[model samples]
Target: MTTTVINHIHETTTATTTTSQTQSPPSPTTTPPHHHKQPPPRDHHCNHHH
Candidate 1:
């Protein structure tokens, strides 16, 4: 009986974790580059001459 209860608890916890992972929104760092602008390239010529 104790083992059965433990198994049920383990199953519930696993289901909760899986649900949370799927329901949570993606983080900004994981977002695609197309959603954001690229920074302009630095002027390498000025740096080299200086």
Candidate 2:
């Protein structure tokens, strides 16, 4: 019974951690930097296409 309770607590913490991690990455709050990176490649592609 104690073991099961401990296992449940551990599972909950792990699940919450994984859930937070999965949710954290899509924030688009970081997109400005990503867009800075994107323009270089896109302009490179456009220059090459030209």
Best prediction by lDDT:
2
Q: Which lDDT values do the candidates have, in the order given?
A: 0.64, 0.80
- Candidate 1, superposed: residue stretches over 4 Å from native: 25-50
Q: Alpha carbon lDDT of residue 21, candidate 2?
A: 75
- For model 1, state the Cα shift of residue 9 in Å: 0.4
Q: Candidate 1, residues 1-50: lDDT per residue as tens digits?
A: 99999999999999977775765445444444524544322345467677
- In Å, residue 8's CA in model 2 sits off its true spot by 0.3
Worst 10 residues of 1 by lDDT: 34-43
Expressed as tens digits, the lDDT of each residue in 1-50 for candidate 2 is 99999999999989988876776566544665788677787888899999
How close is every model to the real structure, measured as TM-score? 0.43, 0.44
Cand. 2 Cα-lDDT: 0.80
